[model samples]
Target: MFFKKEKDNFPAFLLTSLVIILGVHIFALLTSLYYILPWFDIAVHGMGGFWAASFIYYLLFYTYRGSVRMPCFIAFVVIVSGTALVGVLWEFFEFAMDIINIPFLGIGLSGKAVLVDTLLDLLMDIAGGSLAGMLLLWLKKNTL
Candidate 1:
């Protein structure tokens, strides 16, 4: 009822993204700076989800702005495909940080925990991004 038009205004997406990014930053600070690492899969919960969300928002932004000229299939494929690959690279970065050593302490990069978490993180990312894209597309066709 609040939104008068079928299309969602930019504020809805922008504010949501700002909160998500800020929350993720706080969590990141807690984990790294404060050394408050948790047993729970923090990677998946942290910026990973936000990344996917932002990507989906990107798709929606482009679509709403009338930038998506290519076929829908091609556009979705490109977005999803790139996200899947990016997920893989992210895992590598996290793992790399732990594997190398700069001083007396060696980072804990090579382990099953990181590996599994990375895979799961990517899964969540793909699921989130794909869902967002599809949902926005559906909303564009149906209602806001």
Candidate 2:
């Protein structure tokens, strides 16, 4: 439902993936699966980073098409930076949710718990974003 044309398959796939991830996250929150399964949040953050990186990669490719070839390292850097920014913004949103005491979505974590959670989330984000960057580089090398 998100694609405008056949050539937009990658972006459509990314969007669909993101939607599914969000749905699963919401379901987990509503059902308290996050509490039952402590790793759920980490998994979601990793997938979110991957999806964000994919979207940024798509945009970069679209913007640079028919122009000078962009270095693989440059593309990787952009994708990583974009995904990291998304991760940080998401953490901020979570902080806001905690402040507002949104029960289903907020844990109201503080002290070492917040520190550890944020660190793990950021680590997962970097791992996922790095994977996306490597995939992009591989595709560029193998295709055309």
Best by lDDT: 2
TM-score of each: 0.60, 0.89
**In candidate 2, how many Å is residue 23 off?**
0.8
lDDT of each: 0.55, 0.82
What would the TM-score be for candidate 1 when compared with the true structure?
Answer: 0.60
Off by over 4 Å in 1: 1-8, 11-19, 28-67, 100-110
Model 2, CA-based lDDT: 0.82
Report the alpha-carbon TM-score of model 2 versus the true structure.
Answer: 0.89
Cα miss at 15, model 1 (Å)?
Answer: 6.0
**Tens-digit lDDT track of model 1 for 19-135:** 776576556555563235543344443345545544554654555675556556665666666667766676666566556643322224456865666666777767755765565
Candidate 1 lDDT for residue 133: 54
Q: For residues 1-144, could you state the per-residue lDDT of candidate 2 as single tens digits?
A: 222442357767887898899899999989988889989989988988888888887777765663645788887988999989989988888888998998887766789999899889988897888898888668756655
Report the poorest 10 consecutive residues by lDDT, candidate 1. Answer: 101-110
